[model samples]
Target: MEGISTLLSYILPGHSRSVTADYQFLQQSWLPTMHFQASLPRLPVPKLEDTCKKYLTTQKTILSPEEFQQTARNVDEFQLKEGPQLHQKLIEIDAENKHTSYISEPWFDMYLSDRRPLPINFNPYMIFYQEKNAAYNSPLVKATNIVISSARFLRALRAGLLEPQIFHMNKKKSDTKLFRVVTRILPSRIATYGAYLFKAFPLDMSQFENLFGTTRIPEIGKDRITKDPNARHVLVMRRGYFYTFDILNEDGSIRSPHEIASCINSILNDPREPNLCPIGILTTTERNQWAQNRRHLVDIGNADVFRKIDTATFLLILDDDLVSEDFPVLVRHFLHSDGCNRWFDKSFSLIITGKGWSGINFEHSWGDGVAVLRFCQDMKIDVSMRPHFHPEEQAHLPSSSPDVEKLDFKIDDVVMESVNRALKEYKHWTLERLTTKHLLHNIFNKKQCKNAGVSPDAIMQLSFQLALYKLEKRAVATYESCSTSAFKHGRTETVRSFTEQTKALCKAIVERGTSNVNNKEYKKMMIECSKTHAMLTKEAAMGQGFDRHLFMLKRIWQKYYDGEPPAIFKDPAFTKLNENILSTSTLNASVVMGGGFGPVVEHGYGIGYMIDDTDLSIRLAVASYKHNRDASEYIASLISAFEDIERILLSE
Candidate 1:
């Protein structure tokens, strides 16, 4: 009997090697989600001299000649003095710790120690493209699908059946059934070799563990992340009230879609007029003040309720307002809601508005966009392909179905007063201080970029440089995030997009109009700028960038040294470069409509863009404190810059 069973396994359609050749089948089959982690390479530490040279090179593009000279001297002095010792220490630390990257601890520290509120200052948002079928876009239908699909994702992840995330350079060869079968049988220690042989690379999966069942717990000075792997329920918020109900059954199976929808319908239909002392509003307050208020809640016996919230699989927000068709208004709703119905501390909150527009508002400290975006892509695919309920389907449940429990927080006059203050502050912060503008450029996109023999991302970065240079009359420090997830325990590295090559091109276009510009010479310069930007992006992605290395070294100086930082750290140019006046990031996934974050500095702009086959989408946000910085005007400049660059590319 055993022999027959084994023989049948080889002959069955699902288990046959030939059947596995279908990429879709391979994805659905069992593949250890973290099998590649053991063999993933460690992130390298760059040389001290290389870092010093790059630092000076970046400063030269942004500073005046005299300022650049002083900064160069300071960098040279630091290179000769304390730099070597710090670099050596960092190397030794890396050598001793083979399990993680050098930047992991310090990166976590940098995010956790920040005292600003999470909504605008830290948390970022991404909206899902509307569903193709209008029925699936119903609030109840969408919410039910999200819950069901999320549970499937969580279950697959825990059971080790989820496909490992891989980058296939040549999909025709590497993304085949033969490659999957071969890699599956190999031991975890050397499985990556099989992938490398096929020119495929598996990314670090360490961050996936924190994607679910995690919360950013606010403390006085520094917050910490806490997770409960055993939590089977999800926290739900509606009209500023908190509730929880189990989404997973006792046998470890996901609840039926009808049952889940019934539970959500109960919460949505609850007659509780919006909570006057909404506890969630406190999460939007400054971190330290929230910490104090949290302590008071604990002192007054709300610890059990807090525990339920902090340990849930994730949070789902049911918004009472319908989203506006205006792009900027839609962005504002998802980026940071009215601040009353959001618990921004959750690893992420899946928000569904009345009209059924959905997106994610996530806490930034736990992880970067790589993990969150992957989750979003998978959820979107699942919800679209295998939807469990229809638009007009009514939710029905048996009497045995469990009821959702509302979290009744014990509050007093002090807590109510804090809630009032928090509401006022949140409204002022979101409405008055931070503003957003959206641009959808339909002129040209990826095909045009490639036909001109340049990367689409490089073109976008160059457009940003030209736009800012046109608006501000000078180049400022810019940041483009490059994921370092190809290595173990990696987060992100800064790709400084503003280069001398880009600056020169922007100068020519601004000073001499496109009609007067020399097309041949300008095209050569544009290509050179694109090439340079590509090199910077590659270096940053491979963890060989100078920014993280220098950042870590300066942190060591402050923590270990006695009095003041080195001369290089004190330079005005150094401070200005780190300010990141033009912070930019790009996510070009079909599942995402648009995304944005608030400015990093008071007078800066946060730009999130996506480039498709025929158009470009941009979301720009800025703080009101800088009277000179207008998001709308900057967007206008970006549009003009794209037109100017297109002419340079298309010229004979």
Candidate 2:
């Protein structure tokens, strides 16, 4: 009967658990200190002719003269015939929905429908190097400190007390012309403008464990994510064991850092069996498979329990300490979910090691890296500000504590078979298929590029072009993410990184070695490439990018035109130009926060880079399914290319 009850606990979907806080307290706490969404401007649709012209101009650099002419003809016909009608339709839709751009729904749909597994494909982790002091390195100390800091950040977020981020253009170093006036006109605008910080919870806990009960359960297919409306606990995983404890007092105030530290100490001292179910591994599987498995599990017994476990406020993992602070070692355990740690389905998972270094792996579907980065920065600042927790302090703590549930699963032979299968698949996807490279180059950084009459973005991009050309022997259509957060609910636009100037620069590097590449012609071409990149970046930032406009137009065509695909859509050049062979983003992380993500396309490389005073650091990822996609070789080329570019500029 006890085993059956435990089995029933694992499969349930919903629970009748209620937690209460003072209504007046919550009402007063919901103060809007940061009105991130107030008076935010909506994205304006781009002019059809201008978009068409820019599209042709960008393609000229990538395609051959003959190919360019064919594309040019296609563009002209599209502009004259279908483009006008599509533009009108978009305008109508934009007018009808004044709150968001016509393309916003499509963009949102595109992201949600991607259906990629989280680990190496979508969810990216931010790595934080630990402080030198050894006293704050204990697992319990780090865990409790992190919880207190994180809880504070969460409370701040809920109350809108966290100051909204604002971006202003620089006069001395503007990416576009009229930057001085633009800076004055724009003032301080919120990012993802008009978009509030969304709080997504993954589910409920046992009735006895109300406030501190959040569960992360694995089903057959897409694991369940649910949260009780009033729960104030965090889920913690360490050594394949899960523990939940309340961080909030009954009156709704957050517990003191010391109190949280005591709870962590108590948790660490408690003996627990290894996770027999290891249900979190199911999250690492493909969504469809997981969803199917979930249905099977629910049918077995506790449907309500499974649903409750699905919705937790957030997830926290206390990982094992590593001796060396290598990227590979950190990243391996940071993202690994086979059996050791984590239910990867949460909106964000904060991973802290016993060594004190920490990082985050988050589901990309919830929000972009920028939003999460802000949250991370807040946590880092909070943690650094707080004093260290001493182990001796555990003696002077509360005697009676909130109950921490050790969730047990009744696993039959069938379930064990499924677990083994998931383990095999997850191992291949993470350990075998995905390859990561973190390069810390001691080359010229932002300052050097500025001195060389180029934007840092342009130089970084040009280096990638050169590297790709070296590896693949030709240019590939590159998609660089440009934030459109200047406008309300603005997400990202594709800044077509490949250009005629980039091709020219690549050609110069290939034809002339680094020592002899300092000619006036080559220098001119390099600067031009940088200028072109800068212009596109500025345009994209202003919500006037080419790709999103074209994407919306194509969707409109599909919606209105009740016939076969148009000539523009069928053009081989059109298909070839949009293939994202090199998907990259300049995350531009600060010293406090660093983010890394996987490739969008299977055969392409996902590159996240950051530039500092005298250094350039990059995290490169490629799918290992393709035997030929050598990320290490590409990194080598990237290093060589950047070195050559630096040498060429300094040679004269």
Candidate 3:
């Protein structure tokens, strides 16, 4: 060790240094000597650096600032000029294939849940299933390559579906990415057995109630209702954006809560008249109630019901009218089917929630079985981003219907009924839930999380803590017991770009997470915020946090739920969000924090996640008086389960 090479000193000095005399003894005692005699003291060391430089042409080629600038400019011009031309031909070819001359029909091939063994797995259980399947009859379902594409993109999407052979390959391939519709593939495989393609069922608006049945939301035991502080619900926006239902006076404050109530009432009176109005008047009783409760959460007594609607999450544009409420079947189809590559919960914000709307008690369906509750959330707004079911559109409902089995209600039926209700909520919740902040931290990171032994995630345990924490929070209700999303993969058609506007506030909150703020890093962040502000002010047509898609969402929400409408929940503005076009994960970390929620944790976007957190000794809590006890118990159950697993290891 004493004869080690000189490089070892710089690489691993492993010494302590002290600026004061307080620790001089320890520092001096441990440090190596400044001078040391070599084992071969008589030998002369070879000058390696000088010899290499002398043998080579010792010339240095360094680009200066001006040279760098000129080089960058030339490169930029080359790319800009050639990029479009290279892509134009492909774009033109695709556009030319459009069915402009053909007559179009609204008939859609609805995919019933399809089951297929895939190369993908979410939980350890799925991995176990894969091992078991390797021994089962997985003939064509084996590692056979298949090619499926959107009807519109038929040309560019062929050459793969050659033949189904005897191949057992679960090896995930990049080529297979385009075929995997994220939500559709995963949810259907887990929920239903295989893929099903059914024709659209036509519905006559006048006789709509007959095709699909309806039922009242049954009650549960009073003691079953939870009041846990950590109870929560999250609305991660998969797509589009959010907007406020009401606007404020020039002075900048809501007149009163009654204004909201009045607006809700007005919208119900006529929900269909699409004018440039706000988004409160067109909601149903359930939505109106939830809106009122939300107002209370945001400084309840200060403004009229409709006077000042919180428009913080307003302004969204959309690719299609898939955000409407009338297209339930289509919206949920791709949500749970592999028709789109998205995490189920991430694709649709109709996630499970322990936190009720703002303050009122309700359920969620996006992830939970709280169909009715999440439905109430969606009913409160106008979602033009989805397909709206008007009388004319209803005519396209399948002229013929499938025979849906009807089973009598039993005690066990309660769970199924809850499931159906949650499904209904999902139709609308998927879209509405996205634009709004999820019910995630409304309670999880609130004061109550401190008391319930809840806590934020540490660096390593971030995702585990986030999902598990949220799970426990919403597990208070039996219906909203459990549900989750999938992580993204580097599929052939992986999500490339995502908007950061949704999470700006959350980042601001994180910037304040630590106590010390007098650092250079903090100053740099301030400069960034200033830049964001400057960019926002330039785009006056769009407000701050104005993503075009999100802004469009805001406008639709304002018109449907905030202002007057032709019909509402009572009047019949109720509809579905994505019927078949499932959206997927689009949360910006910042939005997760600032939407008036709390301490940001993690969502397993691409990590192998497990909810294993110790040191829950830190009791975090949220305060919501009227809470669901069952949901609370479930949240407790999930948290305790993870804790127990960890505790068992500790005991061992």
Which candidate should be chosen as best, given TM-score against the real structure?
1
User: What is the total number of backbone clashes in candidate 2?
Assistant: 39
Judged by lDDT, which candidate is best?
Answer: 1
Identify the runs in model 1 with alpha carbons over 4 angstroms from their true place. Answer: 1-27, 395-402, 614-628
lDDT (10s digit) by residue, model 3, range 1-652: 2232233234332332211121111111111211111110111111223222211111111123464354445334433543233234323432453421000110000000111111011100000011122321121111110000010011111111111111112324311323233212433213111111111111101111111111111111100111211111111111212212322222222222233223222222222322222121112113333333334433523233222111111111111223222222222222221112122211112221111111111111111112222222222221111112222322233322221111111223333343344335433433332111111211123132223232222111222222333443210000001111011100011110111221232243233432333223333433343344333332211111212122122233443344432121111101211110111221111101111111111111112111112212222221111121222333353354334223212221
Candidate 3 stretches with Cα past 4 Å from truth are 1-86, 97-377, 380-523, 526-652
What TM-score would every model get versus the actual structure?
A: 0.94, 0.82, 0.19
TM-score of structure candidate 3: 0.19
Q: Model 3: how large is the Cα RMSD against the reference?
A: 33.1
**lDDT-superior candidate, 2 or 3:** 2
For candidate 3, the per-residue lDDT at 310 reads 18
Worst 10 residues of 2 by lDDT: 200-209
**Residue-by-residue lDDT tens digits, candidate 1, 1-652:** 2443354345434643222212112134445789888988889999899888888888889999999989988998999998998898899878888889999989999999999999878888988877888878888889988888887788767756678989899999999888888998999889887799999999988888888989999899999999998778999999889999988766455665676888888887787788888899999998999999999999999999999999999999998566566667888888887788999999999999887788899998989988999889988787788776667666354333356888889999999999999999888877877778877767656777778888888888999889888987798999999999989889999999889999999998898878734876788898999899999999998887899999989988888778878898888888899998889888756778888788888888888888754235443333323354788788788889989988877875
Residue 352: error of model 2 in Å?
A: 1.7
What is candidate 3's CA lDDT for residue 38?
Answer: 11
TM-score of 2: 0.82
